[model samples]
Target: MFILGISALYHDSAAALIKDGEIIAAAQEERFTRKKHDLSVPINAIAYCLKEAGIDVGQLDAVAFYDNPILTMERFLDNLVFAAKTDDTDDLMKFSYDSIFGTKLWIHKELEQALGGLGKLGKLLVAEHHISHAASAFYPSPFEDAAVITMDGVGEWATTTIGYGNKEDLKILRQINYPHSIGLLYSAFTYFCGFKVNSGDYKLMGLAPYGKPVYYDLIKERLINIKPDGSYRLNLEYFDYQYGRAMTNEKFAELFGGERRYPESAITKREMDMAASAQKVVEEVLILTAKTAKEITRSKNLVMAGGVALNCVANGKLLKEKIFDNIWIQPAAGDAGGALGCAFYAYYQYYGKKRVIGISDSQKGSYLGPAFSDEEIVKFLSQNEYPYEKFESAEMFYQKISALLQDEKVIGLCQGRMEYGPRALGNRSILGNPRSESMQSQINLKIKYRESFRPFAPSVLKETVLDYFELDGESPYMLFCANVQEHLRKEFSLDSLLDASNMDMLPVVNQARSEIPAVTHVDYSARIQTVDEERNPEYYRILRQLQKDTGYAVIINTSFNVRGEPIVCTPEDAYRCFMRTGMDVLVLNHMILYKEQQPEFVEWEDWRKSYELD
Candidate 1:
């Protein structure tokens, strides 16, 4: 049976198509639209999925939308009815509901029109938002049963949910409602700290180590009440997300004892302290919640998804706590993963398929998206008359790339299948030598143009993970952080960790605190991705070659894109990013193009404007 799943009208919109029990394709709308966190209906992604699967709309046995539109609409109206009487928020409530129903709920009609007016396929079987999130967490996990937790900003009605899944079914045991959301509280702080609400939450998390968690108590007492059972309730008086447009207002600033930090202005000690304090609090609450889930479910394995699950620091803490024997996090833990969620639910929950899940429920190792063939690569280069060289054999290709990385040259490595999640893995990635301490700063500031504090991750060979990190087994998703190994501690100067108790100076020494010091955080931990040959043979081959040459089992791997853009998807996108950035070599399949051989790149003032021109 063919099943098409869609999640849109929310941020990080996406589509996934599954045939039988395997994921045929999955992609986020932002990749095609060239918009970061695009919220529009995933029309482009849907088309891509169908194209990849070589199917038209009529061939699909079922279409599943991520959330129940009627249920969400009911929650929206109910919120409006209560807010109209208590908080004078009728107009804003109407706008929010209207936006969802008007744009997102009507996706079926949009698809029908796109598919040559095929109206019968428009009747999508719907799943609840949290249900989809739970499915996305558990179904692909390498476990027979697992405790599943999904926490995010308001989704239909549930902001947080905890459940347990065994084979084909998931039992949701508890939920936390809206307005009292952990995500909304963090978003409020994100806005107050001069960052975009949903997207900038990570930026705040990354900035945490630069300061102190001094405001933890103050925030707990005044803004949020953390319960013994891991649930939380926000003091609505301090937050304005329920009423007007802005996430935070003057009242929130006064409670925090400052006005909002202005963007592009120098970050101060107070701002860093606030970020650190909030992040610590978030960790504490998430840990408590995870413990609660473990106790209630009594399950040895745990799986998690939702935007909040993207916090690798909290994920690391959960691992260290040893509440569960094993944990699996959806790589696309954000809203984009809702597509996978819906697809899994449609196959298992609705159709009642006798759960014959494979080693990987997703295909190409969750690298289930578009890939350019050697011919396509050549075609694009030849079309543009781009200067390039070609390699006929895999051994020669790996040798050339390894040599470039050994020379500390940044290489754009786009090989094999594109990953389904936010992480680039080895494919659609920018690679550099991790041994150079300055490489981190150079890539962050000069190439990516993102914040220096936003650290990169190491893609280490699975067999050698324990040598460099405190982790065992595979961290394919790059979701959990582990300390640099004890043996390597001296090399990283764990012995001479400088005393910079003054919060203001923390950012200065962040780079000095850990071994694998480039990927390591101030806390001496790294969110690792362990590459296995069974799942990704080509990527494994590359890492093996690098290890034989450099005596290190790891290399720096970050998504191939500049700031304010989605991860590079197409050959054209890869070429543009490579030419514009400090990336020295561009390897699109077998064709290798040097930056100096290419024509000067003219970056579009607006990517959308550039697309329109094409």
Candidate 2:
């Protein structure tokens, strides 16, 4: 059976193709379109998936969308009606009306147009938003039967949902509906701290370790009423997302001192404190929720999907609490993974197909995106008259890259299929020596062209994962953070190195916290991606060779592109990003190109203007 599943008309639009319940190909529309979080129908992504599957549009047995349009329209109507009663939202009503009547009502039409006349022949399946999220979490997981939880800003009427998946039967046991969302509560802090809502939440997470949670008590007293069992309700009077254009209202700003911080402004103590407080609240809520999931479902395993599942800090805390014996998180846990979930929902649940569990997972390491051949890469290099070197064997190639990395030379690596999730994994990643004290600042300022305080993650060999970090098992998708091993950490006071009066974080970010300082955050925690041979053979070999040459197996890994740019999806995209940044080497498949050997590069327009900053 062939199924094409889609998540579109919202952020992170994507398409996934599956054959006989096995994922064949999947890619986000942003990769092809060069737009960050493209919300249109994933036409380009769908075309790529079909071509990769060696099928035409006619071969699709059923096309599934991630959510129901009618249900979504109902939610919008409910919110709009409530807004009219309390706020001056006449203009919002007109915009919301056009947005729903104009686009949400035409999802089927958009799919037909996107598929190029498939409406006449193909069966269209629509799953509830949380059902799509739950299926994505449970079906691809290694667990046979597990408790499932999905939490996000809003999905139709559901904001948070708890479910149980046994064999092919997936049931929604309970739910908390709209306006009382934990995701939105955190997002409100993201907005107030001078960051974009969905795009800037990670920045807030990164900033939390710098400040004390001074407002934890205040937030508990006013903003929310979180119970011992993890259920909570928001103090809606302080938020504006239901009716106003902003995430928070005047009442919210008054609680936090005053005014939302303007974008690109100087960092302050208030933003840091708010970030810390919000993070503490999120962790407490997740731990309590996991306890509830354990008691209700009485399942030893837990699987999670949804935007809130992307909180690695909270994930690590929950893991430490040992709320479940086994835990699995969807790498693309946001809306993009909804495509995978809806497809699984249709195949196993709708078609009544027998379920088969995977040894690790059925996601194929989430490396189901398009990959280019050496021949195609050669053609691009030859056409552009660029210079390069080729390695004949894997042995010499791995050794050569390891040596470059040891000397603190940054490498842009694009190998195999691109990752389907937001994370780079190893295929689309920037490589650097984590032992170098200045490497993090160099990569942040010169390569990524982003903030200085943001920390890098480590791609450590799976065999030596426990040697470097306090992890019980592997973290293949870079979804969790734990403290770097105590012995590897330095006895340094982070505050002693700081200028107490000035709020500049660069001085503090540069302070060495561990033996592998570049990947270590201010709090000594590292977001880790453990490289294993089974899932990522080539990346595994590279890290193994590095360990043989150096005492440590850990190396810095960040996404292959600069800030605001999507991770590179093509050889051309990789090369352009290489030329535009401070990276020293470009590795595409088996070919290696040095920066000094390439032709002089120029862009017609300022490359900085190419992408809108997240």
Candidate 3:
């Protein structure tokens, strides 16, 4: 049976197709639309999946939406009624109610429209929001039985869910309901720290290590009442998300000792402290929650999927704690993964089909997106009259790329199948020499055109992971951070440490903190992706070649896109981004193009303005 799964009308909207429980294709709408966090119905994404499966809409046996819209609307109505009873019916609240009521109440119709009409589409199956998340986490995981947890901003009436998945059956054991969400609490801090809420929570995570968590006690005391078993409730007096569009109220500002930090304004110690405190709180709750799940389910393995699962720092801490024998996190742990989850849930639970477990995961390394043939790439290059050279063999190509990395050239690589998750992995990545002390700043300023504080990830050969990082297991999804090995770290002088403060950490951050300085964060931690040859042979070969030449098995890897843009999806998208950014080389399949040899790109008038700053 062909099942089409979708997550739309929310951020990171996406579509996925599964045939007999195996994922055929999956992609986020942002990739095709060139809109970061595109929330519109994933029409383009749905078309891609259908085309990839070589089937028409009529061929689909079922269409499973990630969440039930009716239940979601009920939550909205409940909140609206509560607001009315409290005599808090203002224009903003009314607008909120009307907007949600008009736009969200008719999601079934929207689904039909998205599928090119209900007549052409098949049966419509609706899965609960958190159930979809849990299914996505456990169904595709290698574990046959595991404890499951899903936490995110309000979904229907649930904010957090604790569950267990055993083979074909998954059950929700306990839940923390709406209005008291860890996700919303983090988002509120994200907003207070001057970042976009949903999208910038990770930025808050990235900023955490820069400051002390001095406000941890204050946050727990005044904002949230977290329990020993991880069940928590927000004080509600300080938060505004329950009734207002803004995440925090004036009382929240008073508690934090100031107003919300203006976006793009100067970064202060206060923002850093808040970020640190929020991150600490999140980590504490997650650790406690994991323990509770383990105690409840008595499962040695754990699976996690949710927007909060994207916090690699917390994941790393949890992994280090050894709460479970093993943990597997969905690569696309956010809403995008919900599409995959809902499809799997429909296939196994709704249809009562037995699941065929895999040794690793059924995600196929999260490389279930599009892959262009050499002929297609050649055709595009030839048609565009682009300058390029074809490699004689894969070995030769790897050798040449390795030499470029040794020479400190930033190369945009588009090879094999595109990744299904938010991460670029190797198929779609901008790679650099991790050993270069200046590589981080160069890529951030010249290539990515983003904040300098953001740290790049490293794609290390799986066999050599322990050589550089203090990690015990595979981190194939780049969803965990670990400190650089002591031998690899460059000891900082006492003067440099004393001079570094929240306001001016650039001096310290610019210093070589480790052998692989480009990927190493200021805290001496690195978000690592262990590249196994079976999953991505080409990328593994490249890293191996770099290791042979430079005695380093790691290379800097960042998503293959500039600021405010989704990762490049097509050869055309890769070529445009290559020409637009300061990257020195573009690798399209077996062909390579040198930036200096390419035809002059007529700069658009203020092209930077085209993309909205995130």
Model 2: per-residue Cα lDDT over 463-570, one tens digit each: 899999999887899999999999999976655655563878887777788999999998999999999898899999999999999978998999999999989999
Report how far off residue 400 is in candidate 2 (Å): 0.6
The C-alpha lDDT values of all candidates are: 0.81, 0.91, 0.89
Shift in Å, residue 348, candidate 2: 1.4
For residue 89, give model 3's deviation from the true position in Å: 3.5
**Local accuracy of candidate 1 as per-residue lDDT tens digits, 430-464:** 98887776778888877887766677789999999
Judging by TM-score against the true structure, name the best candidate: 2
Q: Which stretches of candidate 3 lie over 4 Å from their true place?
A: 91-95, 117-121, 493-502
lDDT digits (tens) for residues 424-514 of candidate 3: 9999999999888999989988999987778999999999999999999999999999999999888765245535553665555578888
In model 3, residue pairs whose N, Cα or C atoms come closer than 3 Å (at least 3 residues apart or on different chains), thus clashing, are none
- How well does each candidate superpose onto the true structure, as a TM-score? 0.93, 0.98, 0.97
In what order do the candidates fall by lDDT, top score first?
2, 3, 1
Of 1 and 3, the candidate ranking higher by lDDT: 3
Clashes of each: 0, 0, 0
Instruction: Kindly indicate the candidate among 2 and 3 with the higher lDDT.
Output: 2
RMSD of each: 3.1, 1.2, 1.6
